[model samples]
Target: MIPIHENLKGKVAVITGGSGVLCSQMAIELARQGANIAILNRDAKKGRDVIERIQTSGGTGISVKADVLDKSSMEKAREEILETFGQVDFLINGAGGNHPDAVTNTETYQDEATGKSFFHLDENGFSKVFATNFTGSFISSQVFGKDLLQAKAPSILNISSMSAYVPMTKVPAYSAAKSSINNFTMWMAVHFAETGLRVNAIAPGFFLTTQNRNLLVNDDGSYTVRSNKIINGTPMKRFGKPEDLLGTMLWLLDASYSGFVTGITVPVDGGFMAYSGV
Candidate 1:
């Protein structure tokens, strides 16, 4: 194992949606780096399970069952964090997901007469996706960032998606939400500048996450056509591993290295945004 950094050791980090697939890996690595983790998740069992791994490894962690979309829930989680850890130093806005209704079967044109056009996409589903990704982050930031404004080397890292950079067919709500996250990252950075807090975001590329498992691969483990297309377009020729994001996570959270860096959506993508399918 590599040596952990001195500054990150014993710092408090709050990660929303910490029980999810990709975010769980990030939470573990942050604990391994010697941070006291406060995990906010709707699933209590999963949250405790993630925390137990860190505890087994001699790391400090406390799992809080809370919904990021609910402001009161997040505020209560913040209180719990303060009771246990005294203060929060870093915040990870990791709660977000897409919906089936917010997607289409193809990227091209659509019919409107039968109400199946892009204009006729399920309004409920689209709103749910938007609330989950964008509204959740905003509420979480409000709760967790309260201490960050006063803590030493404070930083806020929001999670965005590859669809944020450009149009990825089928996921209108997801793309819109992530794009808002990118914009909010910049907005929050300036909003917190006077308090010495740094706000940034991680725009991740395609990976086999729990939410996209059905779309990317089959139950038998064969790659789907969409998966093949993504791989071909990526310059790295492979999907990113969850560990691939740890370096950027650490950099953005650690003030000594990325103190002056703020309001930037650092994409941990394998040239997905750069490739034009030429």
Candidate 2:
């Protein structure tokens, strides 16, 4: 069980992609702190499973099948959440991942031996990733920000990545989209400052999640070449866990902890950003 924050008790939180590995863990942790969870996902079974876990753990929760990229889907999700939870105290935009097609097999650009390089990348694939990471958050905020603003201390937490700070080797689309999230966080914070709604992002380092599990870990359960490089660069010399993010998550949501803080993308990268790979 995770530590419970006093301020989170009885609060309402809506998490997009809550059925996934990391976000589901976030949902569970928030539930332990007494927040009413709304798990929004494209997969009905996955979302329901998360709700079951929350309920079994003695917390209030509901699963809503919603596609983050669709504005109408988000509108329906907002209605369902308001109907069930009464209010949205916090919003977590956690739906986004990199596609294999948007990534290059080779790190550096090559003249004759380009492997999934920029020229070979699919335009449709690039657009899809951008829509999910940046556009989805934009529309979801539009739908949920209304109700969040009604709460005494409204907060919108976005899941950014270390790639946003220092673009990773091969995932250009993911990097650009996450960079947009950081910029949008600042824009939203400033836009809603007078309304007492805080906007911030958590830029996490490499974590073994379903989205990139194959990329980081091999079929034999060994670390991939990229994973080894990441570990070596990190001061901690290890990958992060879902639990590692809870402290910052709670601090950003609880007004007492960060009443004056806003527009910051806090890196939870275990010194990955600090090291210059010397």
Candidate 3:
């Protein structure tokens, strides 16, 4: 079990995309701290599995099937959670991922001899990524921000990426979307300052998730060329694990620790953002 925060006990944390690798771990960690977890995701079984794990560990939680892009669906989820958990004290916007069609095959325009150039990238793919990462957070915030405004020391934690700080190769859509998240996080922090709502983000580096496993790892558990490049670029010379994000997460969620902090995007990137290639 992860470490618990005494302040987080009995708080309600609504994690969008909580069934996925990283966020599921976040949900569990928060649950271990005695928070009531409400998971919103498209996959019912996977979300229920997370809830089951929480229950088995003597934690309280529920899974609500909802799409972050649809405000109505998120509203329904909010109502369900409010009915079940009383109120939402924390909002973790974790629903976002990159699409293959939005990815380019070449790092630069000059290296696009294979016809998978940026010019050939699908517009729909770009829109999907932007909407999923940026707009989804906006709407979820709108839906949950109500309870958050009234709850004790409410906070919003956006799941950003290293791509937001510096665009990663071949994933322009994702980079742009996350960049917008950083901007929006600051905007919301100021917009809700009077309401005592703390808005911030966690910019995670490359962690091997199902979505990017094929892109980063080979069949034999060896790193792909791209993965090796990432490792070399990281000052730590290794990839991050889901647990790497927990300390920062717990810090940001506990008002006693981060009461005066807001509108910042903390990097959990294994020094990838600090390295300048010497």
Measured by lDDT, the strongest candidate is 3
Please give, for residues 1-278, the per-residue lDDT of candidate 1 as tens digits: 54587899889999999988888998999899999999899987899999999999899999998998889988988999999999899989999998888887766665533334586589999999999999999988887776887898899999999889886887889999999999999999999887889999999999899899998997899999899999999999999999889899988988889989999999888998888888
lDDT of 2 at 210: 92
Q: How accurate is candidate 2 locally (lDDT)?
A: 0.91
Q: Once model 3 is optimally superposed onto the true structure by TM-score, how far is the C-alpha of residue 212 displaced, in angstroms?
A: 1.2
lDDT, candidate 2, 3-67, per-residue tens:
66888999999999998888898899999999999999999789999889889989989999899
Clashes of 2: 0
Cα distance off (Å), candidate 3, residue 127: 0.3
76 Cα displacement, candidate 1 (Å): 1.1
lDDT rank, highest first?
Answer: 3, 2, 1
Once fitted onto the true fold, the runs of candidate 2 whose alpha carbons sit more than 4 angstroms away are: none
lDDT of 3 by residue, 115-173 (tens): 57898899999999999999999999999998999899999999999999999899999
For model 2 the TM-score comes to 0.97
lDDT of each: 0.89, 0.91, 0.93
Residue-pair clashes, model 1: 0
Clashes of each: 0, 0, 0
- Lowest lDDT sum, 10 consecutive residues, model 3, at 108-117
